[model samples]
Target: MATIALPRPVPRYRSSSPIPTLTHSINLDGINTSAACPIPIPNKHLPVCPPGPAPSDKPDTPPASPPTKHLKLQPQSLLYPPTNYKKVTHNSSAVYLIDAAGVAAAVNHISQQPLPEAGQVFPWLHGLHPANHVQQAFFVARRKALRKTPECYRGVTIVKADGNLSCSRLKSAVTTDEFMQTAMAEFKDIDPREGFSVRNFQIQSAKTAMLSDIIVYGEDADEVLRVGSDIAKAQRSRRQGLKALGHEVPVYHTFVCTSHFEEFEEHHPEIVVLDTRGELTGNVLDFFHQERVEMATMTKASEIARNVWLGPTDDLSMSGPSPDDEPFDLFIECSDLGRANVPALKNIVRELDSGAETSQYVEFPSSGSIMPPSWPLTEADDIVESCKWIYNLANGIRPSEDEGEITDIEGDSPMSSPIETRTSRPRKILIYCTDGYTESSMLALAYYMYAHGVTVSEAWLQMHIDKRRNFFAYPSDVALLNSIAPSILSNSPALAHTAPQDVTQRIHDEPAWLALMDGSLPSRILDYMYLGNLGHANNPDLLRAMGIGQLLSVGETAAWTAADIAAWGDENVCVVQGVQDNGVDPLTNEFDRCLAFISMSPYPPSTPSTKLTPPPFRPRPPQWHINPSPLPRRRLAQRHNLHRRSNARAVPLLPTRILLRARAPPQRHHPAASALQLRAAEVGGDDAGEARGAGEEGVGMGRDCERDCGDE
Candidate 1:
């Protein structure tokens, strides 16, 4: 259970007597804190921070929201480098160390370790930092990132033991989730909604060294060290017994933030007390943005704020700034004040993001569609290191000093000179489609088509059970995937042998209810603008569906005029010269009159107006611009070649967003031409008066689409 279960009602205290009576309470155990000092103590004799406030202690005053300023956002191009962040201010460097040998009993026994001379140190990997706030921040981010991939099993902590046959015995494969509820039952309780999936896990056996007992519920790192020391002692004692029997210890320390926050309220930043720390802080600072994000979200985490013990000296320390402080700024006095607000101040350094300023970085989309921001990376190399870090610790194996060191890096940004980069495998088990309405269904069809050796019809039939929506794909996407299907299927012997010829023929011969076909198909159009190559100028179905009984095809031979005949014509496919890129942009020159006619009144069969009396002009939904270049499939193909055994074949649709013309604001055509201009600059594009052109009716006012283009 999560520790946050809302507060017991705020107490109403009377001041009748000289002394006030106490009512409100928490359950923090009292600790002896006489050893704290302003001077830096050696890592070997570190001060102990408590876990949280006591039951009877008063709750800290809640802080107010921060002041916000409106900022404009510019369009960002895809397939480019990640947004470059301004350099972050470095204040205090905090460190967390896990005693592998577990020898530390008191702060006096805990010797601080220096940074490795080589390779990278992923801070989120070990969860062994001295700074309580910093470590917790990384932990929170890790939880967020992991939740994005519930289906992926790479990091799941599995305690696999069924009454074991080893030196140490077991009962079952208890997940970290189960273990936490059972083991830490007394310390913290989590609500299911606030709870996170289990990333770190352990196996339980009768002989498994119990480190849980050593962890004092309210005591901090010193207690952790004492627990580690006891575990080390147990491992040493069982060395011969385990070595002769050929078994490694199953008990190991995996992190769980069971402790509450208020334990370390007075914590503050001091100097880097350890010598020759090397690039210790360097690896951490490399992923500096992640740290900034975690800290930023802390401001909104009122539940954690009111209950959890945090250092008083650092940003994580609970804050009660004066009202004069920026409205939402919690720790106003921290040196890295601006840095802590990095999440909120994204527009300060304009970068390409989905929802830069408007979003608060938390969303649980349906069917788990959204991906987590990177931190606890799933890259093959990172996973290898993470597995090594967690498992080897359990097995009493220590990595050599030079083991996981990182070799490549530059300042701030990690990219380097034009080295050929290998693209990663597909993102997950489902194909991604841009149109949200049909993405889930499309993914289902795609999975069956590619993996099951089924014909398009069969695949559609398999997927049309509950989610039976028309799945649309660009003609090119289908062709590309179809071209590669044979090769992939041939390699899968079982699939190849089971694939039937007549059954496959029936699919094409019979036309599936959910077939994957060209966009020209009548069933494919989600709306008028998205008519991929599904229809031509004379297709009645297309004209009828769009309610535009007429199509004023530009650059084709037909009449061109803005009369009622043109504006309200049914079954009318008229051609006009100078329509740009197949009538995509009606706002451009020449076709303005025809576009105006269409905008003025409803098309045929729906209040079919015989005369063109212009009503209010309403532009279509905001134009969704997509990068047609390098195509999604092509990009994925280049990233990695598909093979028989590769399961990471599911590719997400390339992202698309509103570009040149956004939806018209109320009583206004668009935000301002400036918005479009800024978008153009980001993409190195030219709108040719596009932003102002569509919304402005001055040119096409009262013009008739009555005449033919050839005649004109």
Candidate 2:
């Protein structure tokens, strides 16, 4: 890849263009002042600092004080040299001069250094060095000029070893020779026998061994070791008292034996063996000799020997009769055989080994006898019991009489014979409509019913205006009713009123019947219908049939007026009505049994009006009227007195006095009777005084008047 050069910034000077100097030889103190001369210094002449302590203790001198401040001035640009002023050089002693104008033109120059050879060590190819040779060369040159050591190296080759290669015996079929050759080439300097191996190779010092020192040029080394080990072991075995014929060998270990007959014939053409049966004695020899053996009489003696060594056959059928048909051969039985026969047994182990068959055998301790038996059937019974237990656990009870019944046990249910039984309650539905009034509120009401476990049909609305043209009335207009009523009726037939031909027809319709059905009505509007008759009002056989007892409409001119609702006998009913005015319609029949008398609200419809009249005020009696007749004057006067006493402190003095004179005082105030006496005296002469003095004044006066009249 081509290299990119970064531009250098030029330092400005006041005098005839200052010369460009190496960064280390800039003499910052000299050029920092306005009067300094402009002179270029070659890179080689740059002051170099050696590793040493400074010459100190000559004298203690303070730094010169800064000059007084002057007027601020704009900076001037230095004249930089042209781009072609200097040529690139690879020599360490090469020096280049630059003028002040050329200082700004100084950029990274491409190095002409030759590329490092493969596997060669280069100083630049150290830790985290650049991959490009040009970058490393530039870095080296700059470091040498500045008398600084490069922190990284680059452009070095790495050689990787194959010690870490993983080979699978099952998949890799390379011959031993091929595997060993590959391993030897990878670790040419280190002998495999010495166990010298490389792990996690890294270029610690590129100055000595560059990346080129690391190379992975060969195949897997593990395969080489495995093949070499097998071959060497075989050769050693043959040299150590093991007979070898050509590539084949007869080898025997304590527990196993092998003979490569073909290989022996190929390697040893003169070897001959008249009887391979001589290798074993007694029963072992008999075991091999009883086999159906084949022979090539015309073959070489070496071939015959090789065949006998590597391919000798044995008949295991004659070695012992079937254990099931006869007593096992005691001489060859593993349990009866003595320890001294272990070595001989090992040599003929393959002949005595059992064929593939599975059996469960038990041995008799006293007689050392063995017997095989079939698996038991109790496992199936245990599984059946487990299934029953699980069934009982899940159902909380076991089957009894084939039916479910509550048992005396704390949590168990006794089963009873299957019979028809009802497990759910009948659902009750309420259908309601308003002039498409407060749809959100109505939907919320439906949601509340659902939440409370009440089944409610969708509300049917009767609107009086087109909704599309009047967005404001869209929530409460008749057009919305037209659009949504069909869907509501289709979904909830029990709550729907069939089409009516006339007002009378609708009055007799099922919807009207549903409206009168037994349900909790909003208390504010319940006083117009009888609770007992609500459900059966439209039923022909019911007492209130023909819908006479039902409230047909909820208009302002409905059968029950707001005054009637307000005056209802039930306090719960009236209070609930008052609360419903604020949009709270609680579902409690405790309010009123008269379903039609409830008044949800008396507010006028929300249609836009050109002229709106203020609602008139409603007056309420100061006291409750238990009877139609007015209260007695004396009782009125007493109540008036009580009311006045309640506000005595609030009334003006003059008004209070007039009110006190207008009404008789209460009997409870007899002890403070001065004002009563004064009023009585004004009404009648000394009688008032006599009345005040004598408690029975009226009785004596009546007798005196009667006696005087008798004298006359």
Candidate 3:
């Protein structure tokens, strides 16, 4: 009933010549430029200069020396100011929170300057004039003054997505392991490792979002313009939307820099400038140790500072006539502002600063912790002194036996005239930086810890998740925060009378498992189990710090020496030798051993289903056995048909006969054609048989048909 046609021969080229010749070749080296352009244009003749009066009639004069260019420093008053200020937070308090842009805007508005279009001289915000070198220098210097490092990482960086596995490996792991499904669901919301949480934990809010009393901020320097543009666009869209709804945009009073503290106080006495400037002046000339004369002559930023505050030229000096006396009103009340006490945080910054020249590890006996070299480390006493000063300012505490008055050599109030002088804490305060995050972040973190009774971890999460501010911190900064956290908590008036709670005791009593959640150890696989590379396994101290009791090495063993083992006393270490990370190696045989080692750990898995318990022994299933002798070819089809009839799902036993027929060229009368018909009938029953019968009647079958089947 069926026919098979022979396949056509594949075409092969035969050489007409004895030897093969190259085809489609071009002579690249023999390009004829002259032929392409037959005639080149002739060069134009040079005109001779007209004869001038004889040299003897004119007097020879030496060329006048070029006049030297003198740098003209732009006055602070002349610098471009913003027309309107954007409030960073929606806290309807006395103090207004604004960024550098808002500050410049406020200063311009308070000074009663008209908008640039209305005849104002400068059309740009201070330190934002792209064409002005002086403003740029001052802008760069002011931002740099507050930071120990040049760049920082912030906002949804390096976060893990999906379940706790790489996207590529997740498919297979989930497919093979039933326990993984349960584990994945359990730890979905929970952060497996700490430092930063999952991207879901990052908060996104409107421009008017409440950013508490403090905020940590940092980002790569290169991203400043892009990020600023994005923020501006978002704000503009929001403003437009609000206006369409006929709602009025709120405006708050703001001060430009600490330099105008007196004028600012006069207009808004309730707001305070929590100065967090670092030790560096951020002056470009300072790096080369330029003298005062050179700076005064060549540096526009320095000249601007001198113009604003006549008394001082140095930016780092704490002993100024007033806070505003320093260049650009830059002052360092605290050297390292906004440091935290989290180890995971410290580890992150330290790694980031690995190649930095200034970063160095320093141990502080006061905090009983080592400050990572990623940031500059300051003495504990200096931090304490700064804290005390802030405490006095906030609480309206005057000069007492313990603290000195903030005075100048003249014994007069430098902040204001004696008649206008008053002693009370500012009701509102703003902590900000030129760039979005870095300069202001640390100071804000410090303020939060000192004012609130929370530890570094709590403050970090609170600001990021609750307040909705993204910030970055260096390890040294965190270490300093750790050192000073105790004093801050104890000195905090809010917590003085309150009973000890979880927050107050968290610094000392945090659980060991917290390391995994916070990113102190390597990657966390489960609550009890962790995953790490060979490098991490070699560090016994790191494991001990995280309270990791056992080490299970796969693929590669740790490079641990005798001392490493001693340090990790009673080490429960196991290695799966000869297993390489290359995809070829099968981990099937090592599964039981690995599971046994993991289960033997003192720490139990978080869920019962993921416990990796051995299954109860049972006898082999009878269906697994195979028949030794095959049935004769003649009986095969009958047996297969009977089997299929008995159970419609049963497999047809025509594979061997089909393979033999496949090796031979197909013919119209081949007996193997019946085997295919039988297979089709088994699969689809009478309908398939009818279809096959129609196919046999309609088409010819041959080697070409077999080739098409093979291709499919």
Candidate 4:
């Protein structure tokens, strides 16, 4: 309620006289202000005196000495919490009062009457006076909030009183011109391309069990535009995200949290922030503590970051493929069957030295070195020993790998130093020995990776292209190399004792089977549409990618499920229709079942396949699988009619009935025609061929064959 200014220091002059002292009006709590007088500064020659309330001249009182040269006073409230200053009110009187009676009797007797009651303030009196009681304000400006128990505070800020601090949500966090200018400056460094058109941004929050897809609005325009995101199992997300991004013009910079953000990289401005373990600290906080306290709070702070832009100036422009690249693929021939290893390697070396694209070539176990065993045994560092040889062949640098002297290859031309660079590491590897499908495919995969800085999946794909046929990598071998890829790349000595964990995976799924089937039969054009069983045709995951629906597979007793049909569409994928076929087959005793499943039923199919454009090549499926064979031409004619009834764009119809291939006969022998006719047995072993010929001759002609063949 009041402000007081303290007097400043002034130089004193030597004098023979005493100087009058400064004083103040007295205000008190049960204190006599009349006796409270100022202590005067005395001459150095004056004798020291005993300290008392004040100097007394009355004869009734003994002569009093001066106060101490130094002044010291302590307030009662600082050492105690219950004694803090409080506002006075009529409801409750003061509990205690200050006693200024010591000053009343000694100083000039302005208040000779006994000091007022113990619970009330005394009236003010003029003269030098000391405060009977000291006080402090409820609000502190340049002082601590709570001095006694600082332990109650932690972070940089604390809320002592809860007041109405009103704030409403803003679409953008940044409003001031200063903030935008600084953001633009950062953006300029991030993306030099001008014309600041990008607007929206996506911030992906990691999902937890308790909460998912939770979005919080921020004031800054950049933050408000953000949408949270996903993990790598985002096949569905990628497709949906691609479609969503393409609808609007390029106006937003979306931040997706997924790893495979290849879909967003093409046209839109994309910012990807991968989550790291550094985001959270693994510490425990036991108590609340002030941040500025001597012990300092032990709480961990949150980590955050944003990527303004990621340009391609360094990835390809700075470091890329080259002819003299150091790491190159090496192929070690390990034949499954007995063969001359030395002679075979020598032959390969000769072919390479004659006219290879690069001079960085060396055959394992060089020209004169002895060859090792084919099968690696347990405990003898079997496959491991061979691995070291392969490692040396690839890096050309001895990185303190275990068994050092052995790390040095005893070859006629040991690759001591690798060439500076290599343009393509995977392509450089070509392993062959009698048959390419044996034990070497996986080994070739490992070498391919070392030669080409790529992952196991990439290596497999590269090897697949290299052979353009069957390339078998053992599940065990594949697991071994993949596990050690990091160690090999890091050049760690840990690889020496490392063995493959029981983590190898089998080669399953498409195309792998396609290659294995190709060795005997040369390539044949078969439609990607396959039949034979419902299981193959109705895979939801597979169908979704191809955009092929399951309308033909409908009926309550239908083999496919709703998921199967919806796979080609979104999860809510639906179609409406009504029809049922009751017509019976004239040729067979069965009813005509497929009539309701007509082409262009209910809804149109969204698949990209056209009736004119042939589907992808399916090679061929075997005999027992080709179903109700056409030995009798009558059945073949029926197949021709079924093909005509439906629109040809349907993929399910092409699989089982269409596949046709044979090896024993010069021309193909239809499956049904493979049965024998009994009459030709007397003609001896050649009689079997005659019987087959007779069966083929008995086939009936389909009324529609000529028309279908013409279109084909």
Candidate 5:
């Protein structure tokens, strides 16, 4: 892909320059007008330029008047419509005295009335004419009086059902620290005559002052501690207040609800007051005295004091002590208070007196769960670290700094280069067994090889005799051999089995084994084993004809040695014991031996000689006969003598003593033959005669020989 880059054009701005002025006008009369003329011209037809310099530098300067001409000016109608204006009315009261107008002296009259007192009302009369100004004044005064009335408030608890402190109260309470302090002072005031007095109450005074129970609750109970965190800051001032008064008071803050209170009261009723309201109403002084009461109980403090402390506050002094100080026994959080409360909580702890110990309570609103709501709403990765920190803290475990790094199974860097690359060759193993080989043993052997990364390719069970001529007869022997053989053969290499009738019998007796031996194992089983049975052969009669010794010899010579084949069913059990110790598959080994025998057999070389020989010719026997006529004894004797003579002639002559003396055989035993004969003889005699005859013909025999050989 080709990328095109274009540069953005820069913006240009026009230079600030004054425009040239032009003279313009409209002709109103049939007269030539010059630029200097004082006569007014119509704007539309005014000339823009005269192609010469102006008479005056200023364009607005008036020129001399033109000469008068004897012409009468015609009157023209106004160019625009005239607007009519309406007069506004300003009414004033009129006074009248009827004297002169009635032929008696008549006079207009006016009267003045004295101003009324601040709280007084006007009378009906004291005047000659009624005055509008006094009446208007009275109306204004009445409206002002109404405006001065004070507003009245309807009393109702400002707390919301959802546990949200009224916003109005929160604003007021949070802003007015002086007002709250004054309220607290008033709470502390002891008026004997008014039946209000201070009473000291100790909580678990007999026991060491450790936290017994902490309960927190409120509308914004969760936020209570958070916003009130400043209260911890106020701790030092509070302690100062106590010290100034020569008194010691412990204060614990928490945000717990009724359920938590009940639970705490049940567990530590001695310290946690069950009926908070009862305690509050019974003794106001005692209530304030035990400032360190569990937060749940303290929530029921007198309205004045509760409002002062729990309400919103803007005072910097209210901030809490530092975080390094002991954590509060009970930390109360106001549920309604969001992130803003965190600072408050921190401030409260920071403000605590240097050595003062207190319980902390985190209060959530009635709807809020005790758990911190998931926070830092942003991308998942942004808050992941925070979540991890929170998880560690919640689980009471300290997370290590290196926790985020990735590691391998051995806890080492996985990126390091491997020491060596493994070879791709498949692992192979061969198993040998006999009738004595059990299914369990094969399975075990398979498992062992598999664990070592060696896949067993071939398994063989042999029923052939050992040197002792024992036979394998076990039924399971065939079953086990058949079961594992196919898989081993397919995955690794070829598996072979050799046995005479007994082994064959064991196989034939079991359908599965028979199927395997016949190479007819089902496709489903083949798929399961992941091997196909390619071929099979059996010769029962051959086995019967051949003795066990001869078969063993054949098997051994053919590569199926005793050590390789497993044997069973022997009374002495020598072969079986040997197989057990050696863990060899005798059957497969024997088959391998048979395969080797077939592979390495001398048959091809000996085949033509054995098969092509002609059968021996047999002579017909002479037929016997009897003479029918008895006459002529002398003629019969002569016929007999002729027969005897013919028989003698028929007999062949035999050679007498033959002379036999010979030197070494001639180098050219056949001088008539040529180089071709020598070459033909070297190869074999089958072609020597034809080659010699071709050479004798004297035509190029080489080409003929080559052609003949090619044809052959």
Candidate 6:
């Protein structure tokens, strides 16, 4: 592993661009009411109460009412009602903060055509905000629709949803390095420097998704009302023509809340209501019932709200709890719940048991044998417990006496005798969250580990590379998963017959260094060995901690004095200096010496040392043994690159540019665990970065760094 030393208190990487400013004002009918009725930001003592627009001048329009009370609004809810036509337009998919009147204006403008009998209309509230009861209740009555088709070319789908491109931490742009420093600082018990590079690299390497917003109404006043009217006119003509021929038309889904149920009932008297008020359990059932819901993709929406209301700071540290603190877990059947409204989901298992004829419907069961209703999977303990629970449930273990089989029902039907005639259905577990990206990934990885009986690194590669789903898993989360993976995989049903002592002893005997790495590897690649550059060969303390009694260096010599060599033993340490790695150095000639040196024991000559010889490198499945190939330099480089690619394919997030043959493992005493176990030693230097290897395909005698700077 190559090591680069970095100076303490890392250099500042914040951008120097001018900060964007947001202004709030009040508009009363046609009059400017900013001075008289200024909006106040939410405080710790008071709920967010954005001022309503001034009473409309029109005779048919009712006067404005006082803002709602008992609302738990975000600090960013200093919004004012949109006064003009431009305020209530929907041009983009980006979520905007709007009041009930604004929503009505947009929907009314879009609904130029009369509705067909089969046409469905629903409003989807996008972002988190305070539940203004009056506004949410109004969407229940609207029967408007707009149809805008997205254009696709090549493989890219160009969404027409309105809003400017934005960042999650956009209020003040913070570099990935600064963010990692702050994030790593929180786990003070662990060495912040450890895995800092990998975590930084992970975030830097990921492509940030699209996040847009509608902060102010007055900013984009010149777009004229074409967004709503033109879309509405086209939809109106299409609906009329379709209705004439009794053809099926597109359904309308608008963003809305269930705030004012009475007003909704009054407006739509023909529709009967079953349940108006339900417990706010903060699950999918309460999606519309929520007074406040934030889009998981738009993290900066909340941050902007906080900056506008609470105040802004230059520090890059994350405020409050970790991202996706409120976990919403779902264990659904793929056949059932395939992207449908929660309300429409029915119990298919029960229906099948009763022999009831029904249309295709999916089921989403929770709160019993399935899993918990809510789990903030930030803590490692919580994650492990949840994973174990899922394991039991999936394996037909009723976790509690009160809980029953997931498919179990109370009564046996007369059709039960004919159940053998029905086709068997394959059951699948689908772990999902509100946004389908942020909060569910940890649980997904955990489930993968138990189901696949592989390391967390393998699970991660399969999910991101094979599944191709973008998920947000913090380094800390990955570390936690790695540390618990051995235990979790041991519980696999495949090992049910294995002796308890064998499994327990393996787990108990796992090297301390294994926890610090991101991937699982043996304690020793070969001999009392580690693969590193001169930097590592010189760090006596690091060598001692890693339990390395011998060192073999190629091309570069270690900075060891005679005294140092005497301390370590001249026989234990060997360096072939003055050999350049620029594709000309004959590494094959030195392999015998290197192998012989590696064969030497750290103990005195009296101690028994295994007779070591270079093993031929061969690619094999399940477990591939990497050894020095006796081939020439060019052929050896090609073979090593192939090996590196194969190993790197198992974990895509790892540094792929370079492949290292050997790495240092973490000690048992250190509680830190990462997805990979490699080490790069960094000496203090301003220009310190990843150590470079001068060879074709970036293969070097010294491998890439996999430092285990994990916390205790």
Q: Evaluate all candidate structures by whole-model CA lDDT and list the values in order.
A: 0.24, 0.20, 0.29, 0.23, 0.21, 0.30
**Per-residue C-alpha lDDT of model 5 across residues 84-107, encoded as one tens digit per residue:** 111121112111111111110000
Q: Compute each candidate's TM-score over C-alphas.
A: 0.19, 0.11, 0.22, 0.21, 0.11, 0.24
| Model 5 regions more than 4 Å off | 1-477, 480-484, 493-712
Which of the two candidates, 3 or 4, achieves a greater TM-score against the reference? Answer: 3
Best-fitting candidate, measured by TM-score?
6
Model 4: per-residue lDDT, tens digit, 1-712?
0111222346778889887555654456535566666555458967776787554555645676766422222211111221422322211212111112211111122112233221111011100012212111211211233112111111101000111112221111111121112222111112112221111121101101001111112223222222111111121233355457552211111111111222212221111111121111112121111111101111001000010000000112112344443322333334333222333333333334335654222223211111223223241232333433443322232323223312222344433333233211111232332222222344444444443434455444333222222232322344455455553333322222223331122112222222221111111111222111122222233232222333222111223454443343221221111211211112121113222122122223333211121211222222111111111121111111211211111122221111111111111111011011000000000001211111111111121111010011
Q: Relative to the unseen true structure, what is the C-alpha lDDT of residue 544 in candidate 3, on a scale of 0 to 100?
A: 45
How would you encode candidate 3's per-residue C-alpha lDDT over 1-712 as one tens digit per residue?
0111213346887877776455444454555654342333335655454587648755555577664322222222222222333333222212122343333343334345321210111111111323445444543453453211101111111111222222211111111021112222111112112231111112222101210011111222223222223333333444455468765443212211212223323444222222123222231223122332322221111110001101112222212234322111112211223333223222322232233222112111211122444334444544444444443333333434223323343445334223232343211112322211223344556656555556665554444323323333333445557666776666654466655563357578543322322111132222344333332354444444333556555554456666766554332555555554222234567778655554443332111111121211222222211111111122211111111111001101221100000111111110010111111100000101111111110011211121011000
* Candidate 3 off by > 4 Å: 1-378, 384-404, 409-427, 499-504, 511-712
Over 562-611, each residue of candidate 1 has an lDDT whose tens digit, in order, gives: 35333434323323333332112233444464443323222212311111
CA RMSD of all predictions: 34.9, 51.4, 39.8, 40.7, 57.7, 31.0
Between candidates 1 and 6, the lDDT winner: 6
Question: Stretches of candidate 2 above 4 Å error?
Answer: 1-439, 445-482, 488-712
lDDT of model number 2 = 0.20
Q: List residue ranges in candidate 4 displaced over 4 A.
A: 1-331, 338-429, 433-440, 449-561, 569-712
lDDT of candidate 6 over 1-712, digit per residue (tens):
2321212345776778966555855456735654466556548866554588655674644576755432222211112122222323344322223433443334333234332111111122111112433323333233232311111100100111222212111111122232122222110112122211212223221111111112221122332132222332333444466568765533221121212334323453222122233222221233221211211111121110000100111112122433533211123222112332222211333333345433222222211112222323443344444454444422323333222223323333222222222222222223433323223445566666655444555454444333333333333445556566666767644445557677556556544433433221211211222233333344544344333455555554456566766675554455554444322233556678656554433343121111121221211123212111111122111111111111111111211111112222211100111122222121110112222121101112111211111100
Clashes of 4: 20
Backbone clashes, candidate 1 = 56
Query: Arrange candidates by TM-score, highest first: which order?
Result: 6, 3, 4, 1, 5, 2
Kindly list the per-residue Cα lDDT of model 2 for residues 1-712, writing each as its tens digit.
0111222336755778776655544567788798776776568997676677755864435676665322222211111112343422221111122322222121111112233322122232332233444434443553453111221212111111223212211111112222223433221111122221121023232222211111111133333233333333332433353233333322211100012223223332222121122232121122123221111110001110000000101122213323333111111111111112222322221122223122111110110111112212342222222222222221222334342233432445444345343221111111111100111122222222222111221121100010100000111222222223333233222222324233223223433323332211111001121111111112212111211111211101112344433432122121112112111122244325323233222222222111121211212223221111111122121111211111010001110000011011111000010110000000000111111111110111121111000000
